[model samples]
Target: MHKHLLPLALLTVALAACQPQSQNAAPADSGKPESATAAQPSQADRAFADLSKRWLEGWLQLNPINATQVGDHRFDSEVDDLSAAGRQKALDFNKKLIAELDAIDAKQLSRENQVDALILRNQLQGDIWSTETLQSWAWDPQIYSGLAGGAIYNLMAREFAPIPERLKSATVRMGKIPELFAQMRENLDPARVPKIHAETVAKQNNGLRELIDQFITSNADKLSGDDRKKLDDAVAALRKAVAEQQTWLDKTLVPNAKGDFRIGAANYDQKLKFSLNSALSRTEIRQRAEAEMKRVREEMYGIAQTVLKDKPTAPEMPAQPTPEQQQKAIEAALELAYQEHPKRDQVVDFAKETLAQATAFTREKNLVTVPNDPVKIILMPEFQRGFSVAYCDSPGPLDKGLDTYYAISPIPDDWSDEQVESFLREYNNRMIHLLSIHEAMPGHYLEGAHSAQFPSTLRAVLRSGLFAEGWAVYTEKMMTDAGYLNGDPLFKLVQLKFYLRTISNAILDQGVHVDGWTREQAMELMTKQAFQQEREAAGKWVRAQLSSTQLPTYFVGVQEHFDTRKAVEAKLGDKFNLKAYNDKVLSYGAPPVRFVRQLMLDQPIE
Candidate 1:
């Protein structure tokens, strides 16, 4: 649900590295056996490969800063021109790429490459279908504006370009912000901004203001006198423009906002086709989610029954508190949680220590493969806008030697005590341990580092969100299965609670956008399913509305991974060593777990 995963952002980030600018793919790896290609590839295989390369290159051009960060220098000096014409050009490119990919005789590629080609084609085809069918610009203002802020900040954060080049580009892009905002202002239909979205933007505007201030303060020393003067003037103008825009949003945008976040059945069907990359339709996802939810809930209740069996059964268990008292208890619990938040300097240290602990624990027990590359955990930048609390930014395969950034956002300073308390309770210490395991050791950082060592650029560029999030979620349970919680019921409760969140997200995402559910419905589900307190549920409800298709990946993905592991164990029998299996599993980039199974276990890619 992080807007940072927007297609352009994904493309930029996906191939972020120093790679070729030409549409030609990287020459096939030098040292692999000819058997890797499965005899001579057919015309369709060659066509898919060629189209995939061009599609990736075009995408990189569209998301330059991401390319730079991934070690691709092709677009270091350029920000995307998100003009209408530019978007049209991108659409055309995707359409063409899809056509070329579709023309290929898919079965002719090697089994592994055929799977790659199919997904590659699907991605390009989906890109075209989404842009055209959804008319995303009608609802999301973000599409109107190029993500200059994120792209620039990420490049600077990652140290992708030379500081001087980046600084200069930042200054240049700073001059462009007013125009972009102005254009966005003109292009945005007041009626198209949903009231909730307007409110979200208003909250986000404050962050943008802080971001502008932070940029000047942090980078002041890098500016020359003349350049500083120019940047200062630009910053002042942008601040004034933003202030004006905030007024416009409050007075005009919010008041007149009439946009529907839900696309309903027709559009939801289209989005399912595009976003899901599956034959699964909205109704199907919903049914699957409902069935999955019922199964998971029953399982949890079973766990509960076992845990609580010893207590004497009265007519009913005594009620603990009134609703208001329960709310107060939740608030009090949150306060206790915030007290555990590490001091700022402890951020990196905590990550390093946590990573070491997680790795040592996993490796000592040989629970899973731990990659060798050292991951550098950095403070998440304030300029990057939020949805989720933490994320992993891995170096691209093309940029193999560069460090991985496990960015964890420190709590913002200006948040009210209540907000801080609520957030902390939402992400308490036990939750942090789950998150650390997911983002650092055997989760994304470890998996991503291993993927960078993969020989295939194609695989890296086409990494699956499902695989990434699924692996992280799978690890939460895997850790518990390996006795990470020891005998603590509370720790285990938190883990189930986290998985419940994934389940809740799956339900709520489809519920809100596809089924026309209201905010209240979402909150009710989150509160019940995830045991989330009101504030956290409310936040997630809004997030569910703003983003589409992203929420389901965690649960769906993790389940796929868990299922795949079970199958792998059955196949390997006595040969299955947890470490070796995991090592083999991750050596390929983050492909769909199904495809991963096919590759690792030599199953057909059905």
Candidate 2:
């Protein structure tokens, strides 16, 4: 889903940093010198803790925007230095951390510590690969625009402190906007940039101005005279910087952009390892995705025939339909569902209503432990739009009890009436229910609340993207199994469509990045095979090109989660409780599914 739109700096912080917690002081030395008689923590455990602490400190210093996002306030007034020297320093820091991790003896550590060490080591190595080898800074303009938008967005979006104090901190960050843009210019080589990256950044650059105007200018009454004046100046400077960046992107970068959006087979494989945090390779993911895509489409065909049986669009009921017949049946069935969507202005209200119903269904059916933490349904922030249509913005692990936003983007005003209709049909009423289940109840919001309660702050912050997205997808099926919508086959039909979407996501990700699939090929897979609306397919095509290795998370993650639960059910038999199993899996926090599997079964984590 590409849930995050922030730069790698902020993302590194979100994925790596834990809030600083007070540790017990070393015991006073006994009269006798410490000896082997005194039980000591394993050396490996000590090394892991030390390395984690030092690495976090260094990371926060290097990427302050991330620090702020994780509720670390010391660096709130600072933005990362994106100069070439700064990048090199970050690269060196990662190398040093990787070396330290390599020295740790994982075999000597307890199972939990061993897993933590493994996670940290892989994360550090991945960072080094991305920064030094991938060199996205040299080519991706989103790196700069994301930094700019996130700097202000993080500050103003949360009320961790008094508004005035945060606003004052924002002024300091805004003061550095020009310098940040200057570094961006020095770091980005237009000749190496991708046209799509430049084009996207050109649009997102305007978001910086929109953010300031919406958050700061609109709330001028909340600021003191000095704060307001500083904000005004900062906003003007940021606007100028944004305009210059757009000019550079349109004139210099886009024209000369010669780099390929595809990361190629080798890069895609390496990045997939880090992104998926799974044992599956790219080849394996494609195989599984292709098989699943076929299976899900067949299931959708059966349901479509059931729902659309007297309609002329309904295909003959058989195990195998001709490709054309299969496509027609799925589209006709989906069109029926599309007839039930909300009007444009009513979309947000409809989502809120669906969320309430989903929450009740979870409680009534006892599908899983439903957290009492409140989730607010809001319009997607302007700066954060243009990516996914909806996202579950959970609070940082350090900031427990804050609101988790289930933000949905409104229809853009510039869209033609036809495009709007296509989009609404794709996100039809039944689909919105599926989305609410995935984004709110027993999905990201529920899992995230449980993740916040894990004893290890490190695990909480380093939650796996695969596990998060996978669990959301898994919950959709779980809810359907629990007889959501009173056991209507129509609901199951839509659920299968979403499953197809997830499977097709993996296929599209690899197809574009590794197989060199063109836009037409990708669109055909989405619109025809997956039965996506034209607008939805087009957006996904852009998303697949704009990012890599991310789209596969849903398919891979869900499969791992499903396999884990099946294994647990086999072992426990009648002793297995659905609520307990779900609670227990989530209680481990959002680690890789393989790690979660080991923890659940009391096996050594490899």
Candidate 3:
């Protein structure tokens, strides 16, 4: 959860969001000094760099799983301290860092340092607030689940280190899994644990053993003598630990879980501010999302008129339709596209096809500078499947040359045929391409590679999900507009439906946490208003219940990006080059869109 130490930049889950990276591509941080050439750094700037590094190192030590994920191996043998003392240790660490950060005058720093200073401060302050105010440790079981899951997943997912070396790290973390779970049980208050979160982690608990078997047990031969013995002993202890935890989870945590899933308006608002780091408020996000939903639906209906004009069973598509009429027309068109989906087992291969299409189009259209970095379309790791359907897992900003995983969940065996059909219908052929674009290509993969080259690890590590997701969503429109898939009206229609999901996410999130919307209410927004399939809508309902504050990033980030593009286009008139504008926007790394706007417009960093 360095989305608890995975570092903020390592994992970007789109709620609904690859290409394979080039195998021969250079290392992740191979680029030369990103900003050392920028106006000679002031003394304060140098000090700020040193302080940022120290803070990062200390923070990683406390969240060791994240440390490994971020490519810092020093803490590879350690795990996070979730006990009370550990929480206090993290609290104290943030407090001291923030105090030191404030002592540096922003006016004296370079523009780069100034922006990084704000990002670091936002992170430091957010940590303190998270521990002291939000205090999810005492309530949300998902908080601990990340550390448990990441403990093994982060170690084995990549070949960043040698088999023997990484296994050794895994050995230490596995030995400590019991302690991690123990601290988890000790810290969480049963009365405050939400049933949804408890149930989610309960499903996630056994994934630890599965990870051990697949990675550690299978690779145990790499070690020898005492090392082999150590690995075996660690595995045995970890298996027993997981069994005990699973028993406790099912018998105790799930049954006794009594907390409300909704975080309410106040918690939602505070977390929203920190998560997005945008100027938009909860009310503004809703107001904007609601308005955008209407606009997008209307646009979808217009496309539907083209794609569905001669089809039998097509809904009435009037020139100026009412809400009911418009909804019908859009759904009819999407159903047509949904019929053209991949089969159950071909999803990953299909994703690769879409990635190639997207990559070629991005290069062909020159929409943005596509990075040649290596990316792979992989099956979603067992430990990571419960959170979202698909995500882009990149190396830590500090880690170099590792491949980024464009991981998608395979259809579960236990699901009914109807459930599989529902899922494929939602992620149809056209929809999967949209996902590939958003998750990779000129979306997260390209954006992340650009971000890693930005010269500042601080900026790279503390990337804004708002900007990242927003940029990904924005590209869905950009690619379609530039004639992706030969400008198929059906493709455009599905693209609009995807955008509607992004908009609905913002609305659905607040609707759940702020207005206390029920499953029916949430489903109505996703299925009826957003035109999501039953499977997608149902899964998203659980996602909304399981978490909050991150959903709106897509909406808020995209809105800001759209505004930035329009402003810059208006300013440049004939001189605006699409490729140049795109590169420059990404050149600032993945800072909030607001700051990127300021930088692009030559405004103050504030």
Candidate 4:
């Protein structure tokens, strides 16, 4: 593996822009219920709005990278203080905010404020729990790596500011790299640091150099003499800091890191609650995932049957095949699809073609209301490579009308022929189409655009991962069901294979963290049952260890979205419109799925 490439997540980067969305209505033109014009706010609404504004201001000040990512350039030159004192300051801020929230009578607030109140309250409390309980600052080195990387990249990546201004921010942040490294070393206890995390950060340590060299030093020519000199000095200092951090990572951190990666049940459950912000329990998630796996597997086998029909070398296909027969039959069908992958060099172009295709199909079918927001396919930056193969990089709520990046990771040059083939087969032509659908067309890109239209900065910033991921996963089936790709069974099979991944992720997360499953056990579930490629399964094993509750969001989110659709359809029956239903659900900014369901169904916002 290339040590310096930092792998990124394929999450539905569900961030929002400038304003607060209405609580009870869809957009005026969305064909769902909307008041002719919004009513003037009540006193309670005014107070809640003021509280939200204050919370965001303080929160953004404390998290400057987040601010920049969210398009709040006021702190573009700042970086987060992740030291012990910094964590305490954040904790105090959150406690005070939560206390103020508690003083407000939620019932008195407008439905929108009520929803934002809950989301904000959860976020504040989650911050507190994360610091006092999970305490990843002490163990996870990736936090520092990600923050330091984002600090520079977020400033320069977008054209939100002028080149010189962004470069100036980069210089200030770059100059602080040595101090940042000092805090990373001071804040971390090697004994409590997990080895995988230590090793991952050691790999990620010098990715800062890539960011500085590519985004900063490379652009120094764009600045005037004095500014350019300052940048050169900052870049030199940043390089030294990167080297020093790498040395400590390789020598002190990696060697002495002896902490357990599995957060265990107690920590897992608490973190899960905060992370999801849904009422779903771990037990409920497991039960649903197990059941859904069986149903989805049966569906995949049925498709496999169609795809493998009359094939001479096809596996034995009884109508009621045993487990072994079913596995072989599905694998055989998938191999045929895997044979159709693009060459390594063609992956990005393939993704581009697939995205355009997904977009056209989405428009043609009218499956959902397509957003007009521009989305561009780009290569994943070197510093953001390994976590997942790709991601949708949307401008934060405060940064509207900018291009949303549909970034695909180029195949690493360092992989062996076998490894590269394994990756290609896992992400074949059909799967790339599915990924494009999920990450771009009518998925994150579409949902993000919809939520970005909502008025609340609070909802935009505290956007729900469950809703975004679930909506993305849900759209995969919706498109396939609408007969995308001329109703090819191969496409349907690959889509189910992708869905199985969601199911397996939930199962793997619990199995590793709660059930104490070993690497061997996790790999079996991914490769054999989930049908993930060796390369994909191996990466997931690492991801499952690093991310605690994140794995289940895809599963739980999609399940609730499914339930929401079913309920809405049943209620509206003959009148239910897919486009209207989709638009209405997303019209409120992307809140937790349950909250979306509540507003849709007239249930208690709680």
Candidate 5:
């Protein structure tokens, strides 16, 4: 499953490696006749360096499965602990890492090294705050026991480790599942889990069960007799426990789920700072979004008026759905879209064509220096289920070759004809071009190419999620501004529709999780504000519940980029080459746009 969406900039799981331990004693100095100034790169500095490296190594070890997924095979022999002790160990480790990173002299390192230090420091800080304050462990299904079990199993299936070692770890981890489930069943306070998040977990647990069954069924023939017997027994136990867990989830967990879904006044404020590394509060974000929404809506309305000037009643297209017709209309719309899907290969080839086109277009316009070798798009695998139409898989910094998987998740075979149509209506042909520009071509792929070449190891490791996603989001609009539509009205309309998605994502993510919004509220907003197809709107509602504030970055990031570009244009005057500006901006790796802006303006990175 290519769950990792933003290269290393997304969240990470690390393969552990052993390093020399730092001595525990603090540095001391003999008394001097006169007070001595602190020495440069002093003993304390050396201690900080040693501790920081060890902490990084430990983080890698804690996430063996994630490491393997990203091509780091060293931790393939271990599965992480989610037990009380495990959680404590994780906490202690993070705290120590934070202290060590803090002790270092940020100014002493190279500029790239300084950025690396900042990224490491920031990730740890964000992790600590989001966890300790938010206590996502209490609510997030993605980190729940069942999901972790599936992650471990998926890693084993990859077969990246030595056979015996892999089997031994798999067997041990498999055996531990019954206990893990027991712990989860006992420890999870149904009352504490948010209702939507709990429901999502139930849905995800169902998916995990299929993975367990598939694991046993797929590997049954390959295992040795005893190994097969152990795995078979393990699978049976797991399936039964998962089934029992599912019943509990439905009966107890779901029904009793009572925590507030909305992050609300306080937490939303904290999350904005954590997820975005920005001081902008939820209120501020909402204000900005509301202003943009009104401005954009009026502009769109003006465009609408131009097209329908003679018709008095044609102020805007009414949804025209009576109570009974609403669902019917939605179903009809989806069915039409699904029927029009390009053959699967054609979809892949479409991505390729867009990449080539984007590359040539950028070069001709001197938009930015394109990488010599870029990422390639591939089809999404069955193991990774139900995400938006497409996403980009970026190269890990440790991995040399720049391979991009432009994963397109086509309609499932079992989807009803109507269901497929509804999906496609939301992603009409022009919208597809906009999506292509964002995910491949001059968006994610381009940003990734530039990011990979950044000189700092730390920056590479801690690339900003906002920058990556934001660049892609910004590109969709930038291309439109640069005359990408070829004068097609429908294309322009779809582009605005897609931009509405970015806007809607920001508001809905905050609304659902932080404002205690209902599905109906989110649905109405998406449909009315964004003019989204209902089915598509429904999926966004679910996605917002599963993920957190992440959806807002696209709108926020794109706006920041646009603001930066405007500032640069003013300063550079005639010297402002778009290509030079872009190349220099991306070359610093994925810093927050403000940080990138500061660097572009030759200001310190406070």
Candidate 6:
């Protein structure tokens, strides 16, 4: 969901430093028989190790862009062949691997090996589902646009090789852009294309020119004459291809687009299982979300009363305010928080200051082990806009020592004054502090660093989105519990507001995709119930339409983490320590929450 592509198979070697000690017993003392020291690997372990190596090699060869992104330069000059043949080849390969993996006897494996087998099998199954069932190549134009932009962006964004060397690879990739678009046009059925997908791809295709101008041409001085000429020719060809794609989108795709964006109930259910990697069903998720929404709202009402106690129009503190009173009280208290937001241009600066403070607080409280890797705050690239306001772009596990980017999007010039105001209020000062906590410090930046230290390259590359998001959400409560802002009820109030946002995201995702809720219904849930501003609500409606299943990960993941913590605390009682628990949970890399629980509790992995 984060869109940072890497070949999961290619990551085994990078994980060598982070691998756990083998659970198998050591050889007996010298007094024991010589056969004890000559123990051979079990059949399952031998099969797993051999299969993992072969599968990774095959996968990397098929996905060269992923290889490049993950710091493997073997395929640096190659672009993905997005033809029908390419798709079929990939599908066949996955099926073969799945069959091979299935043939192994899991009961014969070590507990750790068994867990890895499960993780790898699920990953393969999910890939098969996407290609065979979901088939985004048939409807999603954004797929091609992403590939084109990423081909050039990945080379320019990192310094894995010399400028000349990377530029040469970029030139080779750029030459393939026209063919890539041609493949996309041939593969996509206009009748199946979503209007939103078409429009977004058109905008993104046009933005490629900006990526060239800003990143490529701006660095022309570093190139030799031959390399510069190659780049110039590639840019000209790429622009023409992008323009043609845009024309096809506006004139052909948009007019004839009859696709429904929703995947409907059956597809949604299957996808949810793979996406979550959790035991909970859709019905269970909805029930839990609805109950939590009510409980969180009640908790927020109490905080709202406390924050608005002295305000002239504040409601009296009742055991339970009527729904109307609760809304009014929350709006008034939020106004106090929103009054301190940064000016439009200062948001990035404010984020920088907030990160520093968050780092200090995390260290002072010993919340978790903060990584020493540097993080930078930068503007979001033009090609990657139109999504969330900010994201943490950490380096691939294979690309060690590089800086992690915390890219924030600036307010668009086309936005009206009212829209701008709405945006700022939603990301008010206190909320920005919470965002930094989630994206940096003890959030993605820190957790990502720890995950990279995992010795299983397979696990490192196949990091779970649910676990990553869940950990960030968990940290918000962790920081709040540690008395952030000297235990300010106002800070807690804003934290609850964010908690409400996550709850609403899960509801809104399911409501629109599964139940066919209209935009107006979604706006009501976000603005009225979650306290999101108008601009924020509108943007989220677009995001929910663009993606499915991902929105629920935050809620489901955090619940698992919370449950895991509670179980550990109950077991340890007075012996429990926060830092130790945090370190141990993160040490497993970003596996499914269930796997993390098994490893933490020494239970047999299912």
Choose the strongest candidate by lDDT: 4
Misplaced by over 4 Å in model 6 are 1-41
TM-score for candidate 6: 0.94
What ranges in model 2 sit over 4 Å off? Answer: 5-40, 310-313
Please, what is the whole-model Cα lDDT of each candidate in the order they appear? 0.64, 0.79, 0.81, 0.81, 0.62, 0.79
Q: How much lDDT does candidate 1 score?
A: 0.64
Show pairs that collide, candidate 1: 16-70, 17-70, 17-71, 17-72, 18-71, 18-72, 44-105
Worst 10 residues of 1 by lDDT: 15-24
TM-score winner, 1 or 5: 1
Alpha-carbon RMSD, each predicted model: 4.9, 4.2, 3.6, 4.4, 7.7, 5.2
lDDT of 6 by residue, 386-494 (tens): 8688887776555546777888988999998989888999899999999999888788888888876665566665678788888889999999999988898888989
- Whichever of 3 and 4 has more lDDT, that candidate is 4
Model 3 misses residue 52 by how many Å? Answer: 1.4
Q: Could you tell me which 10 consecutive residues in candidate 3 have the lowest summed lDDT?
A: 10-19
Evaluated at residue 265, the lDDT of candidate 4 is 96
Say which prediction, candidate 1 or candidate 3, comes out ahead on TM-score.
3
lDDT of 4 by residue, 120-195 (tens): 8877777787788777787888878887888888888788767898898888887776777888899888989989
Residues 503-527, candidate 3, lDDT per residue (tens digit)?
9999999999999999999999898
- The count of backbone overlaps in candidate 6 is 6
If scored against the real structure, what TM-score would every candidate get?
0.84, 0.94, 0.95, 0.94, 0.79, 0.94
Q: What local lDDT does model 4 show for residue 375?
A: 84
For 1-606, candidate 5 gives per-residue lDDT tens digits of: 123422111233221111111121211111111112343444543554465456546665665444444444455545556566766777788887888777777765544444455656767876677556776666654455433554555455443344455555565566666565665666567767778777766766666565655554565566777877876776777678778878887888889888765666577666667667654567777888878876665555444434444655433334443433333333333233334444433556665666677667767666667766546665554434444567766645544453456778766677777766666667655666776788876787677767756543345545676777778877777677777746554455566667878888888887887678888899988987777876688778777766667788788888888888899999999998877787877877676677888767776766
